[model samples]
Target: MSDRDTIHAHIEAHIGEHIANIQRLVQQPSVSLEKTGLRECAALLVSNMMAAGFTEAETVDVGDDYPGVWGMVDCGKPTTMLIYGHYDVRPVGTEAWTHPPFSGEAIPFDGFPKVVLGRGAAAQKGPLQAWINAVSSILSVEGALPVNLIFLIEGAELLGSPNYGKLFERYRDRLAQVSALYGPKTAQDASGAVSMTLGYKGLIYLEFVASTQSTGLGPQGGAVHSATSVVVDNPVWRLLHAMASLTDDTGRTIAIPELAAMMAQAKPIADWERPLLDAMRAGVAGKDPNGFIPGLAPQFPVKTFKEEVAPADLLQRYMYGPSFNISGLRSGYTGPGTKSFLLPDTATATCDLRVISEVGAQDIIAIIRRHLDSAGFPDITIRVMAAYDWYQTSLESSLIRATLATLDAYDCPRTIWPVQGFGGPWAHFAKLLGIPSLQGGSPGHGARLATSDEFLVVEGDGKVASLATIERYYVDLIYAFAAVTKQ
Candidate 1:
């Protein structure tokens, strides 16, 4: 048998051990925001990497932030591949779950034949563990992989990877030698076809605060009788009016002229994006694009609603379009029942601008300030909470070609997305270090990442079906990638 066949056999032989190790990894709580079990998890990852035949593996500290784990295995190959994944997961908010969020329990559900339900099961921990398993299998069977390997797993991905760029900068010389970067693909549409996202949009998270002391538009004191509203201006009303000026009546398009101009100048759909657009159009025509996400359809303006929109238009607006979203709003009283008859002293709205490749977060914030100042709300304070620049890989890159070939080899129904609709810290390596990066892995079909019921599907047949697909895909990807000759 060929070396590739040998690797496949090894994977099949050790599949059970791989799944058990992944369960153990998922059982560890490494919530980045809460700093829960971060150090312990990093240590565990190091130990696992060492056992996988990595020559060196250690946890690198990024100032006060959570630690990032780095590992390397040199096989004397001509090419090196850098793999990136996050060890941290989103906070498990107050959502009633069927099982413990940290319990990597394999349960049999209807649509999904078998699934491992847990916090980081599908978002990353599961896929990362699968990569480790693939590496182990390949080494144990052949004593060497086709290409050199470098692993950089961070613990602050959920926190916008505030310090990841620094880590990349610190290890620039070592990282720059790598030919390409790899990450697990977590985006699956309603059709259940696994997708390879070439890039992601940038993000600017900001909070707009309007208070009597700052804006001089609302009541100066804490709480006043509702009857006093005749004389006292409500900060909530003022803030609402200011926000209204930022968006049109439809609330889908940005009304600020300068911001619109920036988006137009920065983001132009190129030829590489055609395939993604076509897939999105097909998805819109076939299924309710909004069905996978509950309660999201009604939030769109009537004209921009999915049912009312054409396929091409919907893809353009939802995928390529920039957005101004109000994540949360806080004002007077927010009790259980109702507490009326009082004017709040301050009002604040937390918003995020889903940016494109052309714009920077600081520039967007500056433009917002300019718009608000010109609109006669100069006193409003805009605080930038966090920001991440966009990243896009070339469609013709070796990494992408290898991914497409692997998916085609497995007969996995696949879609090619030019860029993900969400924001990520991929720019740290892809754009900053000048390494080509592509997100590809086994099917993460029903992993409700960032939600209370987050899970990873495991198929009964060890295939790429809903729950059983990840390990096999990683094995295929590693082999296909090794076959690619660096240009």
Candidate 2:
């Protein structure tokens, strides 16, 4: 048999073992929200890393927070690659789920192998395990890796990765030596074609709360009954009226004057924008109606019919623009039947603003505060929850060449998104280290990330095939960087 065939067969042979590992990892609840099983999970990963042939693997504790696992495979090569993966996962919503959120049960199906149901099954654990499986297969066949690997597994991404800064500061010297970095949440085309993301947008999440005290109660302060609505100024109506002034009917423009200040700070890079715009149009022909859960449509930022799917409009909105959203709001009683109610003594709303490059979170918050003050809602209270700076990468860098060559070697199709149109922490690496970073992963296809009924169909050769894809791309990346360093 040819070498490729032999390698593929070997990977297929060990597929069950790799899958077992994934099941074990998924079974251990690492939900970051409840602080559940995080340490044990990190230890489990460190053990797996060692078993998979990583020589120096250890779990670094972040004080009271979840520990981040770090490992290195000394390929004895001069060049190094920093690979990042998260072990933490978001808490499963309590209300609806096909299976218990933590139950790692593999349910059998007709055409496909059984799938293990659980949170983090797709968002990361599966893909992370897939990477290890691929690396193990490569070592089994070749007896050595192609280049140096610096793998970092963090357990705090779900909590906004707050401690990442301190962790990076501690290991700055070691991380700085790496040639390039890779992270999770990548996408391939509808036909399983791969693409490289050259850049990403940065983000800032904030919450705004507004409340009216005794003022809305018609000057009679004693929680008046609903029948006296004629005299009382209802807080619900006042809030609705004030919020109406924030956005237009079509949600196209912010009515606040301070929006101009935030807009002026944004600077869109050209090289990153063109390819990103092209990818959106060609990525998916039609938006899947069943892609999201039923009744969850309201949660998505924007819904688009095929007729309104303007690629330019979508691209512009993603990169060089801003979005304002009311995450959630509540005032009066919310339950089964409607009861006679008075204007709530207090009403509150939470808001989040997504900023592109050049927009600072503090600046955006100030603008929002100024606008609320100018709009005569000075009594409203705004609390900033999570603040992050915007970041982007240069598409012309040598790192882009490595990413493109790797994706090309893996047979990633041409029509898929060539770069990330969304935002992440690209600035931390790009702006801080002066080196470009990339975000792409093996987690997009199935319904596992933040959705229920999520399952992974274990095809006979699928695990082997996915591993081989990652191996080719990762090894190609090593060679690509070697060439760059030599030049």
lDDT of 1 by residue, 1-487 (tens): 9876777777777767777887888899999889899999999999899988898899998786589999998999888999889899888878788889899887775366677788998878887887888888778888988889998888988766767776677678888778888886554544556667777788777889888888665567687788988888888877898999998997877899988877776577787677677766776664544542222443342433624665556656666777789988998888788898888898899887887856677777889999999999987888776677888888778888888887787676876667666776666677667778876534655457756778766664333453224555676777777887644
Write one digit per residue (lDDT tens) for candidate 2, span 1-487: 9654565577678866877887888888898878999999999998888888886889988786678888888778776777778888878864488678767666653233466567887667866776676666667777666667788777877666656666677688987877777664435423464444555545555544445453433433334566667866666666666677788876666777767655666564466566666656454335443232122343464465323545445444454566676767876666678756555555667665665646466677787788777888776666655556655546566666666665566555533233343444445666677776776633223344676655444442342224334434444455566676566
Ten contiguous residues with the weakest lDDT in model 1: 292-301
Model 2 residue runs over 4 Å out of place are 1-13, 63-66, 74-77, 94-116, 136-146, 184-186, 209-252, 264-276, 279-320, 330-349, 369-384, 394-396, 416-421, 441-444, 457-487
- Candidate topping TM-score: 1
Rate residue 92 of model 2 by lDDT: 80
Runs with alpha carbons beyond 4 Å of true place in candidate 1: 33-35, 76-78, 93-95, 111-113, 186-192, 211-242, 292-307, 331-347, 376-379, 450-452, 461-463, 466-469
Best by lDDT: 1
User: In candidate 1, residue 331 scores what lDDT?
Assistant: 86
State the weakest 10-residue window (summed lDDT) of model 2: 289-298
Which lDDT values do the candidates have, in the order given? Answer: 0.76, 0.63
- lDDT agreement of model 1 with the native: 0.76
Counted clashes in each candidate structure: 6, 4
